[model samples]
Target: MGLSSPTEIVATDKVEVAFKNLDAAILVGSMPRREGMERKDLLKANMAIFETQGTALEKYAKKAVKVLVVGNPANTNCLIAMKSAPSIPKENFSCLTRLDHNRARSQVAMRCNVPATHVKNVIIWGDHLSKQYPDVHHCKVNVSGGEVACFDAVKDEAWLKGDFITNKSWKIVEGLPIDDFSKAKMEATATELIDERDTAMEFLAKK
Candidate 1:
């Protein structure tokens, strides 16, 4: 028997282990082949890509793999992909909300004069884009290890309805020239990572 025979078996077993341990998958799409796109339009474009990817996963990957859609119009894109692959559970698909959550946490921490860690169980719900509802209603911030309801007194219905929505929702336009060309150029460094790695596949395949 060859000395390397057992090593081959171990390598194969590790592959199986990796496939087994995969809990969920994330799918990202390249830029849609369109201009002047709305959220719905963007979602429509990405859905075509996600649909294919979702089908591939259902056919080739492990059963019961959760899917997270990181592309724009994420929630709708997720829904479209989920529908495309009926074999994969619908609940298994979701959109990324961590960015909004982080932003909210940072804002809250700054407002309340507490470290970000002091914020407990911050829930970011609904559509991942501008339409998302950052419900700080249930969130509690710790000050000196004391828990306090952050949004308890914010009962002004008119202000909450109009002002909050207007302030929270904004258009994030990139590729615009700001005075700080150095910072913008530095930001462009992310393109290399995008070039090298399939971030969508990595997220989906990660344990």
Candidate 2:
């Protein structure tokens, strides 16, 4: 079945007008970073926005609603949102770290001359900032016959940690326009929640 188009709801200060009966909510609104501005620089402004939204979510959203914070300083913003909404489980709130994870996978695949889908287990650790580490030490890439460590396939630590982390050419990626990057990040965040749900189901089944 074809998916129904999402209804758009614009609200000011209060999300109650829009958040009613929400199953999932993705918070992507925040002050955009200007050139030369660091993610940390956005912390205060974004936290204020998140705090207000979080209160609104607590007032209007379903208690089980999952929230993904995609704004700048995402990690801290997510924490602020979660704290503001004490009714929601902390696990239900997450920052959009999947974008960094996907970037790490794509970079590993490019360096190894393999498809991005072939790369697995690339971990994005720490804050979602410049200091974030995309470690491929445990990642595996599908080879001609078997899986091999991505780090072993691409024996350049500098490229993996430095260039790969900094060089996300936002112009063209596999013929897709850079304008879709925002959508891609949102999709990645959604995918993370789906995976989380699946894991929870698996654990429950094993109990």
Cα lDDT of model 2 by residue, 6-94, tens digit: 66445544366666666777888878778897534455566668787888788888899888888755666677778778998888888
* Tens digits of lDDT, candidate 1, 1-207: 112333552223232333333455666653453666653445445655776666666665557777778775455566656766788766677777676777777666776777887776555445443445555555778877678776643334454334543334212345643335324433443343232224333333442
RMSD of 1: 14.4
Ten consecutive residues with minimal summed lDDT in candidate 1?
A: 9-18
Model 1 residue 191 CA deviation (Å) reads 35
Residue 108's lDDT in candidate 1: 69
Q: What is the total number of backbone clashes in candidate 1? A: 2
Give candidate 1 misplaced runs (Cα > 4 Å).
Answer: 1-23, 30-35, 152-207
lDDT of the candidates, in the order given: 0.55, 0.67
Shift of residue 123 alpha carbon in model 2, Å: 0.5
